[model samples]
Structures are given as C-alpha cells and as structure tokens.
Target: MQEFEPATDQLDEAWDAIQHVADLQDAWAAINPQGEQQRLDDQLDRNLVQDSDDEFAEMEVPELQSRQNIHQGDQPRCAIETCDPEITEEQAQHMMRQLNEKQRQVFNHVSKWCDDKARDQSVDPFQMFLTGGAGTGKSHVIKCIQYYAKKVFARMTESAEDMTVLSLAHLGTAAFNICGQTICSGLKINPKSQKEYKPLGEESLNTLRVKYRHLQLVIIDEISMVSTTQLTYIFGRLQQIKGTYTDFGNVSILAVGDFYQLPPISPPTPLCFPHDEILKDIWNPLFQIVELKEIMRQKDDAIFAQMLNRLRERKKKQPLQKTDKELLESRRVEENNLTAPPDALHLFYLNKDVDSHNERKLASLNTEMFTIKANDVDQRGGRIIQVHETPHRTTRADDTSLASYLKLAVDARVMLIANVDVSDGLCNGVPGIVKGIEFCNSQNMPIVVYVKFDSDRVGAKTRTTQFIPPHYAGCVPIKPRKESFKVRGRTFTTTREQMPLKLAWAVTVHKVQGQTTDQAVISMKGLRKSMAYVALSRVTHLEGMYLMDYDESRIFCNEDIEANVAKMPTCDLSKANPLTEIDHNTNFVIAHHNIQSLHRHIDDLKRTQK
Candidate 1:
C-alpha cells in the first residue's frame, strides 16, 4: 500500500515466479509415479498393488513352511529296511554260508595239496566250461560268481577304482555296454583280408584296458553262439594287451551256454570235419568244467516239459500213424470251413471281354485284396491261392480263379493282394469301402468305378483307387444290402523273393524246419524224419511244441539219446596234458614278436619321413 506507484509491476513478477516453480514440480512428479500418486489419488490402482503383494507373500509362506516341514520329521526309510518277506535274512545267510564253506574247502585243498609250481606267483590260469540244457540256471550261477568277484575287488581295492561287467551276443545290435566300453560278437574285418584294419587308438582300446585291467572277473553269456575262430581271435587280442601287467592280466573268464544248441558255421572243405582248433581244445586242462542240471523255465509245467524232453530224445525212424494225428488233421479241416458271422467272405473278378474284331478288351471292374495268415487254418482249404498269370492278363476259363474262390470262402475278413491290370478295370483286395459311383464324358462310356482299400499294414491307414475299363462296365456294388459278406484271399505263390508262390498242406515238421513256432500241431509221421527232429528243437520251451501223435518211440528214441550223449565232450579239468603249457607259451611269444615287429616298422617309417 505504501509503494502504490510500482505495486502492479512487483505483483506481476511474483505471480510469474510462482507459475515457473509449479511447472517444474509437475515435470518431476510425472517422472516419479509414487510422488504423483500421493497427490493424484488416495486409492492408487489397488488391484495392481494388491496382486504383486499376494504373489510375493505366497512365495515367502511356502519357503518358510517347507523349511519347517523338513525340521519336523526324518525322511521315509527304504522299503528294504527289513528283510524281504519271500526270503528271510536267515535263509539267505544260510545259503550264502553253505556256498562260502564249499569255496573255502576248495581253496584250502588247493593251497595245501597244489604243487609248489602251481603256488608260484605265475599260476597257470584256470578256465571253466559251463554247459546246460535250455532254461537251466547256468547264466545265474556265472552272474553270482561275477558279483562275488566285484564285491571282493571292492573290499580289497580303493573306493576310487572302477569296475566293468560285459555280456556279448552273437549277432544284431544286442551288445554289452559297460563303463564306456562295448564288446560285440562279430568284428567287421575285410572279407578279402581277414585282418583287423580298424585300429583302436590310445584313448579308445588302451584307456578301456587300463580302466578295466583291475576287473576281477568277466562273464560271457551265450558262449555257444561264439565260433571257435572268433573266440581264439578275442582271446589272442586280450592276451596281447595284458601281457605286460602280470597282476591285472590274470583275470577270470566264465562262459555259460547250452552246447547242444546250434554250433558255429565253419568254412566248407572237401571232407566235412570240425576245423576249429579252439573247439577241439575246449576240454584243455586249464578249464574247470561245470554242468548245470536244474531246469528253471519249464518248472511250471513239469509233465508237459517231460513229454517234450522225451520227444527231443526220440530218434527219426519210419512214420507211425496214431489216433492223435488223425484227430489233429480232422480238426484243422473243420476250422477251415467255419464261415460264420466273424468269418465273412467277399470275391472280386477281373472281368475280361473281347470285342467283335477278336481283339482283347480289358474289364471295367477292378479290385485288390490283403490277407493275414491264421495259425490254425488248414493249408489245403485256407486263404491261399496260386496266380497262373499277372493280374493284368486277360482272364480265361482255365486261368485258375484260385484267388477269387478263396475270397468267397472267408467272409468279413480283409485280404491284400498285388497286381491289377487296366487302371479302369476292376481292382480287387484294395482296402476301402465304395462310397459312390459316377461317370464322366459319355453316360455309356466305361464308368470308372473307384474302389478304396483301407489297411493299417503299411503303418498308417491308406486308400488307393483303380480305373474300370469299358469291357466290364456292368459290374456294380449291391445297394442297401444288410449282412454283407467280405471274402479274404491270398496269392500263395509269387515271383518276388519275399512272397511264396505255392501253398499246399504239409505236416508241421516239414514246413517249420529252421523256423520257430509259438504253437504247433506236429504230426508223429513227420517226426520220424531228420528234418522234423530239427524242427521240434527250434522251440525254446516244451510248451511251445505240440505233438499230434502220442507214440513212445516217436517222442523218445535210443539213437537220438545216444547222439546227444556223444556230443558232450569229456572235459577232465583236473588233469594237465604235456602240450598245454607249451601251446600257451608259443601263442604268447608269437603275439609278442609280431607286436615288436609292428612297433619297429612304425618307428622306421617315422624316421624316414623326418
């Protein structure tokens, strides 16, 4: 009021300064939400704030709760805390105790009575030959020995030491994998030069040898599958690699298998004789032979097993017609004629018609069939058919409608057959149901009837079509038919290697030679032949083989029994032959010399290059 002359200018300056300060505050608040939020709204997006709080709170509670739970009680114990109910600890201890006693007695006897030479640090290695009938506990006993060795080694050696176990097979991909090492049956040596071209490096074979050198024992399963030549090669390689390490080299090798099974395939010669030197020397004094007599797999059906055993022992002689054989044959024929609800039949023909000019004309109808063989069907009356010519060829009266007839016999069953003539002609056995029929170009022009074949045989469901020719244009599907019959037929003989062309009824023994069957109705008549003897033995179990005739002589033969007994080599492991030590030393020395020569040759090459 006192400075009224310049009051207006002073008031304007204050107002402008206040406005600038307010603008600066607003810009700062915009960058920082918490500060702006307080001024903007009292309840600032409660949903967003509460959602985050709930998540973090939930996480915190669970962490604290879990910690508390862990502190509350100890973890649940293993199921094996107590002895197994089926086998008590006492029983196990008793069995183990007996085994241990036997082992100790043998060890004591060897330690006391064995010659001073045998007691030397360089004790000649002992080999074991374990043979057994199929399903015996041979493999189990060897596995037990391996387990014992592993335990003993673990107890004797440091904890850091490694161990390996291996089981090798004769063929295919089933091989042993242990501690980064694999032992397979066959080596891929060049056929022309039976030399080991693929060399093992220091990192591969040498490293494996080092890691497993201390291995106490090795158990070889299915030893029967190993050829004598292959065994000798493997043994030679092992001896060469471990020759320097006396302590680690003296590893135990246990082999278990049925000797009566298939033998090794050897090279052909003018006179057929066992060419395998190893096979001949299998009964060498170094081996400890153990034969397992207990049959485990066939224990459930003892009677049936005994019956099969008898049959296996029987000799091949003259055919004997028995009541069982007649009954089996009759049953087979009856099964073939059962054309009931589940077994429906359908037939298709490749209709061929010639024009007035004597020229061959293709039919408009076409079909294809797919068939799966049934195990019980009679060979003569079942779904088998022999095609006289290619499916494309013109159908004649004597052309043999075998395929067509088989299709009519079996109803509601699927059939798959190959080879169809014209694209427009009738195609039979192609999977799929006919949906609809239509014609194009001319109404009378050969109607292309499309047939779809449905099958899961080729992995997934598929549909294929065929074009019908003008000649068999009249062929059409029945309309609104109930309880329709679908016939299934198969072409027995074909030119293809995979497909068999001829189908005929034969005794099971004749057909199943060198083949395996889950269930077979074998005729006693066929059992008299040598081929039948081979066929019956193909099955692994007695239950797998069925006999049609129950003749004592058919199932058990004195000659066959004698033959098996003769095959069992008299392996006297206790006695030592004079040539044994000499042979072993000779083999070892030869291998050593060869290895030295190889090393010298390599060194010379390297020096020359430098």
Candidate 2:
C-alpha cells in the first residue's frame, strides 16, 4: 500500500479538535473534581489516534501528552475553592451561638486550634473524636466548623482562593449532610483495593500540591464506619499527598460518630475493635475523645429516649425491660396492608426483599411506566470497551446502589440515590413522589423529573432552570447524575450517567443509617440487634415507628464494641443540663421482681404509681 500522508487541512482540524477536548475537560473538572471522566476521555482520544494511518504515528500533539507538567494556569482549581460557596463570618458566629453546651465546647476547642494554625502553621495539629448518639448535634457542630473554617481561611488567604478545611464522611449521605465528600473520594482512595501508597514522584507531587495547597483541617463524619485498614489507608494517602512523614501529613482532624449506631462493614474491622494493633496505635494516641450526651431529637419524650438508650447498649445478660418491651409492642404493626401508612418507608433486612417490595408497590400505582437506560462506558487495561446489553439482562452489579435500568411512573414513590442538595434535606435516602417527567427536546430521554418530596423545604428556596407548575410549587426538579464504579467480578470499570433515584416504597435498614424519618415501617426479620436499633431510631417519635414481625431477640449490642465504648473517656457534662435542681430531681420507681413480696403492697403501689 502507498504510504498514507496526512493532509495539512486534516492535521489542523485534528489539532483543533484535540484543543477543544482539552477545553471541555477543563470545564468538566470544575464541576467534577474526581476527574475520572476526563481520564477516560483522554484514553479514548489516544486509542483513536493510535488506530489512524501509520504515517501519523511519529507526529505527536503536545496537548495529547500527559498533563502531569502542564503550566500552573491550566491546572484545575482546588475543588473546595470552586465547589463550595463562601460562608460569611457573621453567619458562622450565629451558628456558634445556637450550639448546645457540649457542642459549643467542641467547637471552641477545634476553632481555637484552627486559630493557632492560621497564626502559625508550624505548630502540631489538633486531633479529636466527637462521639454521640443519633441526633446529639454532631452533624450540626460539623457544619459550624465548616462555616467557621471558610471564614478563617478566607481571611488568611485574603483572596478566598485557598481552602484550609476539608470535610469527609464514610457514607455519602453523612458527607452531604455537612456539604462534604466521601472519604474514598476525598482521599482519592479505592474502597475495594488497599495497595500500599508509595510516595509520589516529583511531577505527581507537584500536581497534588496544587490541588490541596492549603488544606489544614479535615472533619470526618460517621467515624464508626471507618475501619482500621481504611484508617491506615487515609493516613498513608494523606502523608504521601502532603509530602510529609508526619501523621496524616500533620493535618488537623475532627472525627465524629457513635460506635453503637453501626459497626464497619464486613471484611474490615471497626475502629473500636480492641485487638487490632494498627488501630490501637493510630487511633488511641492520635485523637482525644468527647462524648455528647444530650438527646435533642426526643427532647419532648425523655421517657422514650431513656428507654431507647437502655436498649441501645443492653448487654447479653441485661435483657430488655418489661416496660420498654410493652411500649414497643404497642407500636407493633400487625400487617403491612392494614396498618402501614401509605407514605411510611418500609425498612427491610435484605436487598431482594426491598426490591421486591418496591416493585409490588410500583405496580399498584397503575400508571404508565417509564424506562430510563443508563449510558455506560467501560475501561479495562488501556482498552475502551462496552458490555453489550442482552435482551433480558444488563451488566450491572446486583449489590451496587446504582441500577442499570431505572423504571419509574407518575405518582411512584422514589428515594434519591444521590446527594443533590444537602442543606435542603435533598440528600441520598430522602423520599419523594414522582409528579411528572420532562423529556429532552430532541430525544425521548428524561431531562428532569418533577418530584414532590416529603420534605417541602427541600426545593422551596432552591433555584431551578425548569418551568415549575404553579399548582405543584413544592415539587423539586431532579436531573440525571453521572457515577463511576467497578462491578464486583468484572475487571473493567463502568461510568454511568442516569437519574439519581430508586423506587423507595421500601428500603434496607443499612440505607437508613444516620437519617431521620418522620414515619417508618420497620421489618424485624433477620436483622441483628445493632441493625434493629439503627432502623428503629430513624423515626423521630415512638408513635411514628411501626414494627412488623417484632422480635426482642434481635436487640443485642456488639459485646466488644460496648466494652470499648465504656472505656472511652467522656467529657464531664455536668453543665450540659442547664435545668435547675427542681427540674432534675424527678423520682424513679424501681419495680419489684417478685410478686410474692409485693403481693400485700400491690394495691398501695398501684395507687401511688398512678
């Protein structure tokens, strides 16, 4: 074959196309700092060039080269500086004023450390763990710190171009609650793999430095979900990225969570596991512990709150109390069809059950179904590929939160699968009802789905690009989200773009962790004691919780975790109760175990107790 020579016009066009791709990538990075899409796009461009005529092999475009050493002006701006909006100092101080005693104490300690660091970066950074039960304001304190940090950093940098505080959480919902990112994403970690993190080369280090130039404090929420191995990975990755050998590269840390809520997922030992030498070495010394004791959510029902607390830490020998059991039994739901509220979320133990329940509920809606297929691209070993969908099945993992195909209908109850807006309570696991679907102008694909959320305030104040129906003023418009993940048994990674929603007539207990629901229909089948507590606690009031197939057997706390938590140092909360002695001097009646001894006094006791 005659040697193929590229035409000058074609070469110039190709160069222009490459330049255009680079510009698009820069814009994409501004929105998505993870940069996975950009990397995949770059690989696709290279593969196309390689398959071109042989004469063009030797001609290389500089833009197509690796961006490791690109000029500073072209480097992506720090994610925090761009993604997060500014919080005025006045707003932060106002939040500080609203904190409870223990919350204010934690804030003062951490903010003081931040003040010291702002004055002198050479000082050793502060590390602390703030532990509390559900609804004790750990998340609220985190927000305050985040707002305060932004103001401090703005003052320090003088141009608001640098970020000094980073927020992370083990769960996406918790992360969004504080306007933060998941730990795996924030640290650039692979949750499935834990290869040793070696120091980066000069060029790579330079790039990392540019991205995290002024990161000083890290606030990690849902600390109980953080495992020993993951903790080590976090330290190692931060050390490497910061180019220092110090613990977490001398970055200050505030970890907040309760061990009694939920332990780490399997295959990874929890941070509270006593036998892990690595955890003991890294956690015990690196952080001071502060426990928040006030039960703010159930402030109106102190008796119920006390009962839940007793059950949360009940040991194997300390069986459930008769009074608590009777109270829970009173709220027991006899049947889903008869007693369960139409809007109450059914919390199940298994994913199969949740899916089946959701499907059944959706079919009951009797509306025209709408199917949305995910747009996916797979990358494996320097090759770009696609897993063709068969007539029956698609190539998505069964356990992944994201589905290959989402089926929805008008009036279908759905839950958000992604964090759209945290402050507005539009994060993952929030329930909503589909009102209408807006299709693309050119195609049948859905551009936005109108969802009237259970929380009316979710989209009330938020601005939207779509036209809202005057009658459905509270409906929020949800757009499709792009997610990147690897299948369990697959070698390739799949990047999918689809709507961030799931049929939410039913959901798993694990998904409801750290979320508060107004009403919940909880299934007690096959759930452990810890899981049962997590599910039950999601409902704010006892009257709002309806248990199906209630079993007291599934109500025991982890023995090891209980012991470890007992030994944890707690802040003296003597001042936490601001009430006077009269308010705190309520008398408690101890019930007699034996009827024989109390037989004579039974009549007297009944009159006095009543």
Best by lDDT: 2
Residue 406 local lDDT, model 1: 20
lDDT by residue (136-226, candidate 2, tens digit) is 7777788788887766766666456666788887755566556676665565544543334433344444655776778888888878877
Q: Cα lDDT of model 2 overall? A: 0.64
List residue ranges in candidate 2 displaced over 4 A.
1-94, 198-208, 266-268, 275-280, 335-338, 371-401, 418-430, 438-500, 566-610
Q: Give one digit per residue, the lDDT tens place, for model 1 in 165-210.
A: 4343332111211111112312221111122222333333465466
Residue 416, candidate 1: Cα error in Å is 25
In order, what lDDT does every prediction score? 0.32, 0.64
Q: What RMSD, rounded to one decimal, does every model reach?
A: 32.0, 15.5
Candidate 1 weakest ten by summed lDDT = 61-70
Off by over 4 Å in 1: 1-124, 156-161, 172-204, 244-249, 266-288, 311-610
